[model samples]
Target: MKNFSTKALALVLWSVIFSFGGCAVMDKNIPGWSQYRNPDKVNELQLASSSIGEGNPVLLIHGFGASSYSWRHIIAPLAQKYRVITIDLKGFGESPKPRDDLYSVYEQARLVRNFILENDLQNVHIIGHSYGGGVALVTSVYLAASHPNLQNSLVLMDSIAYPQDLPDFVEVLATPGLGPLIIYAIPNTIQVKSLLKKVYFNDALIPQSAIDHYAGNLDKPNAKYATLTTARQMLPTDLQQFSNNYASLTIPTLIIWSKDDEIVPLEIGERLHADLPNSKMVVLNDVGHAIQEEQPSLLLPYLQQFLDAGTHRTAPNSK
Candidate 1:
């Protein structure tokens, strides 16, 4: 019995050691992880973005934990007709992740507003996916209230506008102490691949290159912490409140959702459509949450039609 007890204790010690030590190993092996662990020199970080093509500006905002590269498949195609601007939100992609910053949707919306104003963009059309959709919605509402003439239209793809059950991984990251441990321990490759599987309808559709790209971003300093912070700040009340005045969004809106999306689900899309009086919802079959990457070909026509419709701005009912 004494021997057995000693062995058990030894095993427990090893387990605890590995739990913490694994993150250290990951930090070394994963490219970019070491560099991102340190705080950036600049206090106020500028969002990393690229503008391509010419015509009416269309800004593409990626979802949670995603960078502007998420729109790689569609940017060139859309740029053929309209100026396509893709941005990495402050905490994701190439954007600087400032420590202790609030990664809330409202904060993100403010950044979007700044981007538009600074660029002197007019009649801008916004397209966002997942969390990006939430940011886009908030941005639209703010524009409507402050500068109605500047806002033209919106496209929400599997957006997170309404309160819903958090995904298991997100729930884990949002937890207090355990969240940090998990975030630190998991390697970027493993985390990115696992998430890609969940976001893609067909596992086979996820390319290794895409996984590598996403993992590279995950390795950046403060990336994991930023993700955890964002998750914690994503309170349902906050999201719902931001979307409260969505009914007053009179701008032409298009909501595209994957019929079988396991992430945001179709119900959320339906709710967004119902809330926006002038919005139309298009359900894509056999696709998942990352519709922009997975099914861009199918999405192009709907986007073209919306953009061609031009500004159909009407005054929304007073809230």
Candidate 2:
């Protein structure tokens, strides 16, 4: 009986150790446990999440060919203040690449709207980079007309909205019967290497691990078609100006641009600031378009400062 009792105590001790030392044990299998584990499993529409603190909310929308995973380094840190929601946009990253016939900018806006509705958030602030910025702009217009009560502030980070000539690579990709076929022929490795060169001002700054993750999904089954279609749909439009439909949005808008941005260029970001009545611009020097990724430390704090300022109070119909 004494031996049995002793063994029982030992068993309980081991159990306690297992519970308390979970991190140590899990550390051994961290890679398997990581969100990146099931790369084979479609990370579609996944929300890479962390607490947005106690306030309205802030949603971070990633750029083209990137996922919410791009914001992984940011999720926890930003959660310290406002609730941060970063989602893999439709047809990019892990989101479902449904047929273009079905998905439009309107539908993309709906994806955002649904996320907002499902979460039951109000007075939301959306920050978008690259194409995602355009989506946010379009979303602002839609919400102003349809769901004005759910006011949202726009933060455009080098978004492409106006009818600027498409980037040369995109232009080639858009050429009839030539782009898709050509893209299909190039091996993903070569394609990825080329894309990295074009997108980054300092290609050496982008890690191969990041490239692997992006390339892994970017060339997935339906992504190219969907991307082409979305681009084509918005090529000739005053999408940013559609917000003018709402008398005066009066929502505080912040547009940040990288003076050195090679991708979208500074002109578009500046133009967005010019068109939006209640908007301001911040141009960072020596930093290319993808400021969030290129210089997160310098970029994020500035954004946080914007959020914390009195600017958030600029509601159109204020109490």
Q: Write the per-residue lDDT of candidate 1 for residues 59-111, one digit (tens) a residue.
A: 99999988998899888888998999999997898888888646777677777
Model 2 ranges with Cα > 4 A deviation: 1-55, 234-247, 310-312, 315-319
Q: Whole-model lDDT for model 1 versus the true structure? A: 0.78
Error of 2 at 128 (Å): 0.9
Task: Candidate 1: list runs displaced more than 4 Å.
Answer: 1-43, 311-319
- State the weakest 10-residue window (summed lDDT) of model 2: 24-33
Against the reference, the lDDT scores of all candidates come to: 0.78, 0.64
Give the lDDT of residue 194 in candidate 2: 61
Q: What tens-digit string does per-residue lDDT give for candidate 2 at 1-319?
A: 9967765654454334324422110011112112211123222364334344566688888876677876776667777877787787777776777774433444566567667766777888888888787777766765665677675577888887665655555554555554555456555555565666666667778777877887687568898876665544544243334534433556778888878776787887766666666777888886666777766887887778777773345643321
Clashes of 2: 6
Provide the lDDT at 232 for model 1.
68
Residue clash pairs of candidate 2 = 44-94, 52-82, 52-83, 52-84, 261-288, 261-289
Model 2 root mean square deviation, Cα atoms: 17.7
